[model samples]
Target: MSQNNAIYKGFKVSAKVRQAPDAFPGGDVVHPRFLATVTITQVSTGMGSQRLLPPEIQQFADAPHAAITLALTSAREAIDGMSTFVKAK
Candidate 1:
């Protein structure tokens, strides 16, 4: 997926999509399934940040672009939430 990289609240958000077999058999015709992964890292330190979201299984989609969009949205929301917590302290 293109435009998979984003910067949010001083952190870098990188998104990638991977193909995975469907848990349940798809009788007759099988369709491709994709999982989107989002990685957040500190731009200043280049260190990996903790995942604010849950497992990739919850972010799966039938279409690659939809999966990527979901990943990007989740990543940005996580960054925003983290920043808000830091400022609260």
Candidate 2:
């Protein structure tokens, strides 16, 4: 397959418990509290020759900054939805 025809393989979304406070029962604390963290990483094959993408794709090849920005924005939107649901309870 041509290099440009390769799909982005996709990215990884990771989450860690940053902070979780334990519940206190009577005068003793049973569970401990900890903080939570979430991170996202994009994974893709290295850039190939410009000929790989269609003419349209070639246009953005020079603008990696914009591409990354768009990716982050999308990721943020997805994370926001999850956060809202978690907070609802």
Candidate 3:
């Protein structure tokens, strides 16, 4: 989306899995790690468009990266929890 239409802007975080040397001897190598990348982008009209529009439109700009990261984490956790719950059922 374009900047004008963006309600907020923040970074984009991601997770990466790769092989790395284990600090201990004769230990299982490799592990998964989440790497957060600070990518500045405009929050689309879909995030909180309704509440952020009209009277609150003027306040939209350079949103905090931490807030976006937390939201992403929460969403991921919710999805994971749902998957686990479904699998158990």
Q: Pick the candidate with the highest TM-score.
A: 1
Give lDDT tens digits, candidate 1, residues 1-89: 44477777777778888775765664545578888888877665334434343333236788888988888888776766653333222
Clashing pairs in 3: 8-43
How well is each residue in 13-88 modelled by candidate 2, as lDDT tens digits? Answer: 4333323335555566654434323344444323421112111111111133443344344445553443222222
**Which rank order by TM-score, best down to worst?**
1, 2, 3
Q: Is candidate 1 or candidate 2 better by TM-score?
A: 1
List the candidates' TM-scores in order. 0.65, 0.28, 0.25
In terms of lDDT, the poorest run of 10 residues in model 3 is 52-61
Q: By how many angstroms RMSD does model 3 differ from the true structure?
A: 15.8
Residue 20, model 2: Cα distance from true site in angstroms = 41
Compute the lDDT of residue 40 as modeled in candidate 2.
49
Estimate every model's Cα lDDT from 0 to 1.
0.68, 0.34, 0.29
Least accurate 10 contiguous residues by lDDT in model 2: 53-62
The runs of at least 3 residues in candidate 3 whose Cα sits more than 4 Å from the true structure, single-residue gaps closed, are: 1-63, 84-89
Query: What does candidate 3's lDDT look like per residue over 5-86, in tens digits?
Result: 1122232223222222333376655443222222223234334332211111011113334333544454344333432222
> What are the clash counts of all predictions, listed in order?
0, 14, 1
Superposed model 1: Cα runs more than 4 Å off: 1-3, 25-30, 45-58, 85-89
Model 3 vs. true fold: TM:
0.25
Q: Between candidates 1 and 3, which one is better according to lDDT?
A: 1
Q: Is candidate 2 or candidate 3 better by lDDT?
A: 2
Q: Which is superior by TM-score, 1 or 3?
A: 1
